[model samples]
Target chain A: MKRNSTWKTVHRYGVYNKSTGAKVSLTGGFGYDYTDGSTATRGFISPNGAWFDNPTVAFTAAAPTKAVTAQNEAKTPYTLSWAPGKLSKKVAVVEALKASGPNFFTAWVDNGGEVDVRITNNGGTYEAKYYTMGTSTQIANPFTASVGDDSSSPIIASEITSNKWLGWMHSPEKRTQIYWAGGASISFYQETNMSADATLLGKTNGAGNTGYTTLYAVENRAIADATKFPVEAATWVASTTDAYEYGRVNASADVRFYFTALNPPAGKLARTLYLDVNPAGPDAGDKAIMFNFSANERSKEYTSFAATPVTATLNKTGSNLRISNGHTSPWSLGIQRWQVLLTPHFTSGALVRLGGTTQ
Target chain B: MIALKADGTVYAMSEPMVLNYVHAASKDMNENKEIVFVKEDGNNHNPVPALCTAPTASRHYPGGTTDVVVCSVEPSDFGTKTYKLRYNGKWVNGLPDMEGRNSENDKNGFRVTMVNPKAGTVVTHTVGGVTTNYVLKPLAVAEAFLPESNAALCNDINFTTVAQFGWSMSDLPSATMIPTAIPNLGQSAGTSKFEVLGRQWRRISLSIRAFS
Candidate 1:
C-alpha cells in the first residue's frame, strides 16, 4: 500500500461527552509532513533515547461507500474502459454520487461543482466517465462495460452499477492524462512514481504518443473538444497568456506552468496554479524532483504553496512548507544535504538540514 | 548574491558569501545566519523580520481566550514571506499594504492573517475606511461560562477593552445559601447614603447579568 505522505493536514483533539457520545472541548493542531520516510520504517527515538516505531493508524476510508468504490477503480487490477460520448454518461455518474449519501462528495454536488465527462480512448474502447472537481475526495467512474459496438450509431449507456464505479486517479501504465480542476479547493494528489530504469511514455523512434508524454492537464472548466481528444501532441495548449496552462514534463527541462482561471463558479475563488516540473529522467544523472504550489492559507489547502529557498543571509522568513524530495521512485528523503538554521530560536550549535533535488 | 532556484534551492548568482550573522552588541558570529539581532555589524546581514508580537500569556476576552508568541525572520529580496506558528501549527502570512499609507503594511509592520478552518470563515475589520480580513475560530459555548481564571485557554482575534470587571464564583461567601441578616455583603446598608450606593450596585449587577 502507498504510504500516507500528506504535505499539509490538521490533527483535531477533543473531549467526548460520555452520555451523548458527542465531542466537547474540541481543539486541534495543524501538522505538516516533516519527515522523509514512513515513520514505521524510519522509526523514532524519544528524548530518553528509547527507540520505538512511529505511531500510525489505518487509513480510514472516507465514508459514503461510493467514494471507496470509485478510488478502487483507479488502483491495480482495474483497467479503465472508454465510452463513445461522455455527456449522458456523466449525468448517470453524478446521479449515483448524489444517491450514494451525504458526504463531502455530495456536498460538492450541492455546491454545483462542475463534473467533467471524459470519453477519450483511454487505453481501450469504453463508455463515458465523469469526475466531480473541488470535493474533499474526487470520485469518478471508469466503468467496465463497453457499448456502441457498431461505428454507425453510438449508444449512450445510462446504467452506473456498483461494479462499474472507479476513482478518478488514472493508471499510469496506460499513459493517460490526469485532469486537475483548478480552483480554490485543495488538490489531492496520489503519489505517482516514475522509475529511472523503467520505460517511459516516449518511444525509441524519438516520437512519443502525446497520451503518454503529457502527464498533467490542469484547467478549471471544460476545454474545447478538439484540444482534449485524439490524444495528439498538437492538442496540448502551451501559451502562457491563455486561460489554462499545461506542462509536458521532459526529463531534462525545468519548466514552470502558471495558471490563473478567472471564470470560476459563484462562491468559488479562482487561484493561481504554480507547477515547477522536474521529471525523473536521464537528467541529473538519473534523479528528478517535482515541486507544485497552488493554494494559500485562506483556502486552508494541504498540497503545495509558494516555496522560499533557504538563504545564507536568512533575510526572508522560512515558511512551513511540505517539500517532496527525491528524483527516484518511492521518493523518500535525504536526497540533497545542506543545513541552515530556520530561525534565531535555534541554538548556536544546532543545525537543521534541508533536503532537495538541487542546491 | 544568493538566488533561489525554482525548486527552492539557494545558488550563488555572484561570489558566494558565508551565511552568518554578526551580532552588533557582542560582535559574536551566528553560524546559521537565521536569527536577526537588534544591532548588526556593518557587514551585510540577514535578520529575521519582526512583523507582529503577541502576549506570551493568554489574553482573556469577554467570551474566549487566546495566547500569542512573537517570532522574527530576516527580510529577503523576495517579496512577501509566509510563516507557521509552532504553538498552533497553523500557517500565517503578512497581508499586503492595501492603503500604501498605514504602518500596518509591509513597509512598516506586517498584518498577520489568521484562519479558523472549522468555521470556514473570514472576518474583515475596517477602521478609518481601511479594511483587513481575519479568520475567527469558533469559540465553544462552554468557554463563555468558565470561571474567569480558567477562561484563558481559547484563541481569538486580538482586542483590548478599556473597562474590565470580573467576579468569580469564589467571591461569594456561601455557595449553597443566601445570607439572611441584611447581607452586609461589603456594602453600606439602610441609610440615604446607602441608597446612592445601592443604585450604583444595581447598575453593576445588571451589566453582569447581561454578560452571562
Candidate 2:
C-alpha cells in the first residue's frame, strides 16, 4: 500500500482477507508506507500478493489460523461488539476472536462453525491454524455487577483509609457541625479536610430548618451503569421547636429523612436491607415528638419516650423501616438530644446498626 | 485543535487510536508473574499447611515429576514470598522460566497457579488412572503444590494453564438497539451507552493486556 499512488487521496483502506474473504478496515490517511513484507497477519491486511488496483481496496495474502481446542473455550480472548473497534460499528453482535504471538492477531466468527482458538509455544515459535467448534455455547461473564462503595453522601475524603470506610458529617444547615470517625466524634466538619462549601450528594435543608443530620452507605446487589448508578444510602435528622398555648410541645413531631436511589429503574432495584431503630414512632397518645423513618412502608410505633438512647439495627433482608411519632399532651420546653453512632459490618446478616443516647 | 478550560489552562485532546497504540505497546504477559507477599491467617482451613506456612528457607523438591506447582498464600504483607523451584529431581531454590518462552528443558518445569474456584468446590483432573481433587476452601490461602505437601489433601500437581479472556457487556443494550447519535445534547450525549468511553478507559488500564 502506497500513499497517493493513484494520484488521488485515500482516507481509509479496507483490507480484504484473501483466505476467508472478510474485510478489516484500517484508518490511515497519509504518510503510511507499506512494503512487501511489512504487512500484518491474522485478521489484518497482508499485502504480499498483487497490488491494489483500486485505491480503497488493498489486496492481502491469506491470513494464518490456529487449531481450536473446544475444552479451552473458557480462556479465549474476543471482542464484544460494544467495545471500540470495527466490531463496534457492526449491527450484529459479532465477536472478533484474538490470538497473541510476538504480533497481535484478529479473527472473525461469522458462521456457527468459527470458534476462537488460542495456541502458544513457549519457545516463541509463530505458527497459526484454524479449527471449528460446531456445537458449543457462547462465552459468558460470571458477574454483571460493577461493585464499589456507592455511598449516599460525598465521602469525606480524609476519613477514608481502608475499604468500606464510612464517613459522616452534619449537614451545613446545622449550626453545630459534627463528623464521625469509627463512631467517635473526630472534629467539626468545617475544621476537617473536607471543604465547608462542598456540596453533598443529595439535597440538604438550609440553616434553621430540619436537614440531613446523618448519612450512611449501603451495599446494592447490582448496578447497571456504574457511571449513573445512585449511591445507596439514607439521611436522618432531628428537629426541636417551641410550644404554643397547648403547653410543652417543644420538639416537632417529624424527623427529616431521605433515601438515595430508593426507586431505581425496573430490574435494577438496589438490594433492600431493613433498618430497625429503637425508641422510634408514629404515635399520637402520650409521645411529644414523633420520629418517623419510612422504608418499604414498614412502620414501628413506640408510645412513650424513656431515658434510653436511640438505636438502629438491621432487620431481615428484603425489608424496610418506617418510624413515626405523635403528640397528644404537652410537656416541658427543654430540647431532646439524640446522638446516633452507626456502624456497618458487611457480613451474613448485613445490618447497618446505630447506637446513641437520647436525653 | 485544542480548547481551553474556564480556568484558561490548555486541554490535551488525543486521538483514540493513540491510546490503543500505547496500550498495545505496554502489553506484557509476565506482568502478573510476581511474588505477592501475604499474612497467613491461622483460622483458614489450609489443605497444605507445609506449603502455606511462612517459609524460613527454601524447601527441596522430590523427584521425577514433570511439573512443579507453586501458590502464594492470601493476606500477604505485601513483599515477602516463596521463590523456590526444582530441576531434574533436585531443588533449584528460585523461580525459573515455567512458561518457557526462552528456555525449554526436558526435566525442569515450574508454575505458580492461583485458583479462585468457588468455596468448597472440588475440581478434579484425572490422568493415567490417578484422580486428584482440588479442594478449594473459603479463603484458604494456598491449597496444593508439588511433591505432595499433604497426603490427606489431594497431592495431584498438574494444574498450570492460562487463557486470555475479554470484556463482556451483559447488561448494556446491544449495538443494534442504540441509535448512532441523539437529537439533543442532553438526551443523546448523556445516554448510558455513550458513557462507556470513560468506563472503557478504566477497564483497559485495569485489566486489558495488549493483544500481543
Candidate 3:
C-alpha cells in the first residue's frame, strides 16, 4: 500500500441568496475527509446556537464526536450505489463529491457516510453500488397471502428491488426504467469493529466472479432511486417525484433537499423547507414534517398548506429535515428556521451498505 | 185695480184683488207699485203667474179647521208688477230678496224702521238722489229697517208734522178729545176764550215702520 496524503482546505465555499442576502447551509450536511482521515473528523462544525446565525465553522484538531443525534437514528439506514469508469476522469468526476463536500451531499456523518462501497460488471457495463448502515435491523414483510400491507417498503421482492433487474436488465427501455431491487442481506456490516483488521467478503481475483467487490457499513441508508440526486458531474435528474424544483442530488451525499412549493418563487424565488417534528399525534407517532418557508409570514403555512407526506420506509434517508419549534420563515425567529446541511459525493458505481449487490 | 189712499183706507177691486195690503196703513209709505212677489231662478215654473193681480200665497190647506182662503190664481204677475227696491246698501248688486213663493215671511224682503244712530254709526239712507249723515253708537245689531228710526237713534230727532221740517208726520186730537173738551164736546161750548192759553197735543207714539 502507498502512503496517504494530508488534508487541507483546497476550495472553501459559502452559500447566499440574492433575495434575503443571507448565507445558509443545507440540512444534515455531512463532513468530508481528505485522503488521510484527519480532515474528515473535524473542521466546519455548525454553530452551537440556532439557525438564523451563521453556521459557525470551527477548525480544531478535536475529532467529531460519533455519538448519534436524533437525526442519526431517524435516518436509520443509508445506501450508496454508482457506475465505475475505466479512466481517472470518470473516476475523478465521481470521486470529487467524496473528496470535497459540495452543495449536493447530504448527511451529518463527518465522513460523507461510512460508505459501504462495492463494484460490479453487468456483462460489459461496469456498475458500482454505494450504501451505509442504520441502527435498525431488516424488518419482516408484515404481510400474508390474504392481506399484504407492505407496498410502501423501500425494498420490493420481499427484499430490496431495483429496476432493470425486473426483466433481468432486458427491457426495450424507453423511459419505463422503473423497478425496485436491494433487500436486507444477512451479512451486511456483520463484523462489529472497523478499527481492527478486517476483510471484505470477496477479493478482486476471487472465484470466477472476482469482477464484483461487496462492501458494508453500519447504520447505513440506501439512497433509493426515488430519493437519490446526482449533481452535474455525471449529473442525474433526481428521480424524486416530490422535489419542489428540478434539481439533482448525489447518492453518497445525505442532506434534505431544500425546495419551494410546486409553485416556486416567481422571478428569483428563495424559500426554505423546514423539518418540524410533529408532536406525537393521536397515533403517538411524532413524525417531522418538511415545510417550505418564506421570509414573510409564509412559514406558518408549512403545517397546513404546501406540505408533502413521505413514506415511513423512506423516512429520513439522511436527507430529511428538522424545523425547530421556534424557527420561522423570512429567516427570522432565531430557532424556527430551515437549518439543514447536505454534503454530496459521487458513487463510482459501488454496491455497498445494508441493501446492496447480492455478492 | 185697487186704491191705497194715504188716509189708511185700503180698497180693492169689487172682484177681490188686493190694493196695497202691506204698505196701506204704514207710515213712511208712498204710492210705489206694491211689489207683491218677485219670482227668481228665471221662475219658469208651472203655469206662469198672471200679469197684474197677486193673490196671497197658499199651501195644501191640508186640514179640517178654519183656514184662510189663500188661493193662487188671482193674477200674481211678477214680471209686470215688480217695484225695484232702492238698494241703498254698500253691497254690490244689493242683497238678494228671496223669491216670491218663498218670501211670505223671508227676512230679505223690503224692510223699514226708525233709529237715532249713535256717534260713528252711519245714518245715510238714499232717497232719490239726496244723501244725509246721522252718526250713531256702535252695536252688534244689524243695519236698521226704517231710515226714520235710524235717524232718530243717531240724532235724537223727533217725529212731527211733515210740513214743518220733513223729519216726521202725525196728527193732533180733534175737538172732542181736546184738553178743553169744548164744555160739551162742541167747538163753541168752551168757557174761557179770554183767559185760556194752551199748546197743541200730539199722537200717542210714533209709527216708524217699513215703507212700500
Candidate 4:
C-alpha cells in the first residue's frame, strides 16, 4: 500500500517521516546505499517500516496562475483571468518579472478576472502591452492603437512652432506717449542783471524806476480840472478901491451918504459888503451908521445905535446900499470918517466889478 | 418914676409926686415909664436873659415842671430895687409885681405845673408875662388784648406766656398762640408746611404743647 508522506531524506541529524511522526537518528550505523555513490546513504522508510534507498518522490507546490484571452475585432485589448483566492490581497501586473516597470499595472484583488487598462504610446510609434507582476508573462494582446501621451505632463519646447511662441511677446506698437501743456515761461534767478523789452499787460513803472523796469510809465496829476485834464495854478481877481468922506450933524439928526452905482455883474451874485465908521469930538456920546438902498433894492443895516469906530458886514443881496448916521440921543454934531466896501460872487473865469461910498 | 433935668442931672420921685409936678409945670409934660423882666433856666445856664414883659399882680410861672428862685437882693430896703435870680450859677432879672412881692412859693422856688398832664399834653405858661408852650411826654407801656382768659386753647401744648418788661411788642410779640392743634407735637415734622411759622418766630423762644 502506498501512503502519502512529507519527509526529508537529507537532514543533518537523520530523517523524519511526516506521515508517521517518526524521527530516525543518523548516528546509528544504518548505512544504506542510493543512486549516486557509496557515500550517498540517505533513504526513506516505506509504509511497512522497511527502509527504501530511493527517497525521491513525485510532489509539487501550488502557485498562483493566470490565463489570458486573445484579442479580437470585438475586444481590441486582451484580458487576464485568475482564480479568486485571497480577495483582500492586492494583485498587480508587471513586466519582465519586476515589481515596478513602465508596463506595470495594479488593481484590487476583488476585481475578479476583469480589469480595463488604458494604454498610451507615450509619444512613440510602438504599441503598449500589459503583463503580470514579477513574471516574464504577458497578456495575449499587444495593442497597436496608441491613446497618446498624458495631456497634464510638461510640454517640450519643440512641440510649439516659432510663430505661436511669438504671439505671447508684448508689442512695442501699443506703448503710450506722454504730453505736457504749453504755458508762460517764468524765469527764476538767484543773482542776475536782466534786460529785456517785454510788454506787461496790467503793470506800470512806479516813481524812480530803481531796479525793475516796467512797460507803462506813471506821472502825478493830483490837481486837475473838471474834465480830468491838467492846467496851471489858480489866480485871484483884484479888489476894487474903497471910498471915504467926512460929515457933521446936530444931536438926534441924521447924516446920510449914498453909493448909487453899487451893483453886481451878470451871471454873478453879490457876496459881501463891509462898512467902517469913526467919530471925532468929545460931545458925540454914541453914534451909529445905517445903509439904505433904493426902494426897488434890498436894504442892510450895519448898526442900530453903536459907539464910533464900528465895522460890519452885509451878505450878498442884489442891491446898492446908502450909508448914513443913525438918529439917536446924545449925538452932537461931529466930524466922522466913514468907508464902505462891496464885493461880488464870481466863478473862476468870470469878471467882477464893485462900487461903494465913503463918508 | 425917673426924670432927666435940663442940667443933665437924674432925679427919681414918687409916681404921684412926679405926676403932680408935671401937671403944675406944664400940661404937655407926661410921665413915661417901662419895665422889663428876664428869666433863665437852671439846666441851660444861658448868659443872655430871656426878655419878657412886666408881670401883673397875679404871678405868671414858666411852663413845665422846672423849679426856679430869686436868691439875691443887693439893696433890699429900696422898694424899686433890682432883684436877681441865680439860676445854675447865672444871674437873671426877677421883676417884682406892683405890690413889691417877688418871693418864691417854696424853698425850691417856683414849680410850674400843667393841669392834666399826659403824653403829648401841651401847656402854656407866662414867665415874666411871655407865654411859652411845653409838651408833656409820658413813658410808653406796650399792651395786647387776649380774647378770652382760658377758654381759647393754644394749639401748642407746651406753650407758655412771656413777660418782656422794657421791650416793645409792636409787630412780633414775644409769645404767639395758634388755634389749631399741632399734628406732630415735640417731634420732627416736614418743614415745608411750617417754614413760614418758623421764620415768623425766628428770634423768639418756641414751645409746642396743648393748652387751654
Task: Arrange candidates, best TM-score first.
Answer: 1, 2, 3, 4
Candidate 1 Cα misplacement greater than 4 A, ranges: A1-104, A107-245, A249-359, B1-142, B145-212
In model 4, the runs with Cα more than 4 Å from the true position are A1-359, B1-119, B139-212
Q: Determine which window of 10 residues in candidate 1 chain A has minimal summed lDDT.
A: A84-93
The predicted structure with the larger TM-score, 2 or 3, is: 2
Residue A318 of model 2: what lDDT?
22
lDDT of 4: 0.21
lDDT, candidate 3, B52-159, per-residue tens: 134334521233222212112222222222111211111111111222332333335322111111223222322334543322222233331111223444454444
Score chain A of each prediction against the true chain A by TM-score and list the results.
Answer: 0.17, 0.13, 0.16, 0.10
lDDT by residue for model 3 over A81-123, one digit each (tens)? 1011000101111111112111111111223223222223333
lDDT of each: 0.23, 0.23, 0.22, 0.21
Candidate 4 chain A vs. true chain A: TM-score?
0.10
Q: List candidate 3 segments past 4 Å from native.
A: A1-117, A122-322, A325-359, B1-212
The segments of candidate 2 whose C-alpha lies over 4 angstroms from its true place after superposition are: A1-200, A214-353, A356-359, B1-113, B116-212
Tell me how candidate 3 scores on lDDT.
0.22
lDDT of 1 by residue, A1-359 (tens): 11221111123212223334443321111111222243313221111111112322111111100000111234212111111111100001111111222212211222224332333332232233344431122233222244322223221223223222322333221123232221111123222211110122112222222112212222222121222221211121122322121222223222322111222122211211222233332222211112222212222222222233222211111211222221222111111111111222222222211111111
TM-scores for all predictions? 0.18, 0.14, 0.13, 0.08
lDDT (tens digit, per residue) of candidate 1 on B48-148: 12232434344322232333233332222212222111111121212111111111212232222111123322323333455444332333311111122
Q: Candidate 2's residue-wise lDDT over B1-212, tens digit each?
A: 11122332322222111000111111211222223222222312221323333432233233322332333432121122112111111111122111211111223432332212233332232334454443222322232212322464544333453221233345558889887753343554656755666576677677756543
